[model samples]
Structures are given as structure tokens and as C-alpha cells.
Target: MANPMKIRAAVKDGVTEVKVLMSHEMETGQRKDSSGNLVPAHFITELTVVWNGKTVLDAQFGPAVSKNPYLAFKFKGGAKGDKVVVTWKDNKGDSRTDEAAIA
Candidate 1:
């Protein structure tokens, strides 16, 4: 299993701001190992964010993204104590889901 992602969500003036830090190697195939072998591309390909059961953000990523990606976003219509969920799927079929309450 991959490491748990760090997430923070806060609502202010009816807008919710979210920040996430995901832990992953995010290797690109273009890189090489010490033995001069190509590293397989391993990266998050899809990510989704939901608030109160409604989808707020849906995104796609590629190997170009840096390791341990950090994401920040804002959306309308969230309140304190609302549930915010985040899920990500990597190219290797590994997926992780986490949730937090709006503060």
C-alpha cells in the first residue's frame, strides 16, 4: 500500500479551499537507474475530489508531474463540518482514498 496523503480543507465565505500532498515516487520512463536501465513510468493518472457527495474536481496527471505532488484548489458551496473526499489512481492500478471534514 502507498503512504497516506496529507489533506487539509477549510471553508471560508462559502468557498472551500483544499490542499493535498501525495506521496509517490512518480518515476518517469525517461530516467535511468544506477545500472543504466530505464525506470518504468509510475505516476498518478487520475484524481477526484468530492464534497458532500458531489464531485468538485476531476483531473488527470502524467509522468511529467514531480514526485510527491502538492495540489491546492478552491470550490464554491461548502461549509464547516462538510465531508471532503479525495481519491487517486496510479498507472500501476494502485489507488488510495481519503477524507477530511471541512474546518
Candidate 2:
């Protein structure tokens, strides 16, 4: 299992901003190890963000993304007490979900 994600959310002027930090190796399958063996592809392929049970952001990523990726975005219609959830699934079938309340 991968490490838990770190999420932060805040609302201002009726808009909510979210930031996420995910921990993963994000191997591209093309890199060679010290033993001259190719590394298998391991990366987050799907990411979803939901605000108050409504999908706000959906994304698809590839192995090209850097390890321990950082994501940030903004959306409308959120309040200080609303819940914001972030979920991600990697190519290896590993998945994690984390939530935060708007500050």
C-alpha cells in the first residue's frame, strides 16, 4: 500500500481551492535500475475530486508525472464546513482516498 495523501481545502468568496500531495514512485517502465533491469510502470492513472458529494474534478495521468506529485485547483460552490474528497488509483491497482473540510 502507498502512503496516505495530504489534502488541504479552503473556501473564499464562494470558491474553494484544493491542494493535494500524493506519495508514489511513479515509475515509467523505461528506466533501468542499478542492475540494468527495466522498471515496471507504476503511476497514478485516475484521480477524482468531489465537493459535497458532487464530482468537481476528474483527471488522468501517466507515468511521466513526477514522484510524490502535487496538485492544486479551484472550484465554485463550497463552504467552510463542506467536505472535499480526493481519490486516486494507480496503475498497480493501488488506491487511496482522503478528505478535508474547507477552512
Candidate 3:
């Protein structure tokens, strides 16, 4: 299993902002190892964020994204103490989900 994601969410002035940091190797398959062997592609393909049980953001990522990706976005209609969930799935069928309480 991968490491747990770091999530931060806060609501201010009726807007909720969320930030996430994911841990992954994100190999592009084109990179060569020290042994001169190509690395297999390993990257997140799908990501979803939900605020209080409602979908807020959905994204698709590719190998081009850097490792340990950081994502931040803002949405409307969230309050303090609301639940924010983030989930991501990689090309290798690996997935992770984390949640944060809006402050």
C-alpha cells in the first residue's frame, strides 16, 4: 500500500479550499534506471474530490505529471466541519483515499 495522502481543507467566506499531496513514484516508462532498463509507467489516472458527499472535482492525470503531485482548488458551498474526501487511482490499479475536515 502507498503512503496516506496529505489533505488540508478550509472554508472562508462561503468558499472552501482544498489542497492535497499524493505520494507516488509516477514513473513515465521512458526513464532508464541505473542498470539501463526502462521503467514501467506508474502514474495516477483518475482523481476525485468530494465535499460533504457531493462531487466537487474530478481529474485525469498522466505520466507527465511529476511525482508526489500537489493539487489545490476551491469550491463553493462548504462550511466549517464539513467533510472533504479525496481519492486517486493509478494505472497499476493502486488506489488511495484520504479525508479532511474543513476548518
lDDT of 2 by residue, 3-103 (tens): 88889999889888999999989999999999999988899999999987799999999988999999999998899888899999998899999889899
lDDT of 3 by residue, 1-103 (tens): 7899999998889989999999999999999999999989999999999987799999999999999999999999898888999999999999999999999
- What tens digits encode model 1's per-residue C-alpha lDDT throughout 1-103? 6898899999889889999999989998899999999999999999999987799999999999999999999999998888899999999999999898899
What TM-score does each of the candidates earn?
0.97, 0.97, 0.97
Cα deviation of 73 in candidate 2 (Å)? 0.3
- lDDT, each prediction: 0.93, 0.92, 0.93
Model 2 reaches what TM-score against the true structure? 0.97
Please report how far candidate 2 places residue 10 from its true position, in Å.
Answer: 0.5
Query: At residue 57, what lDDT does model 2 achieve?
Result: 100
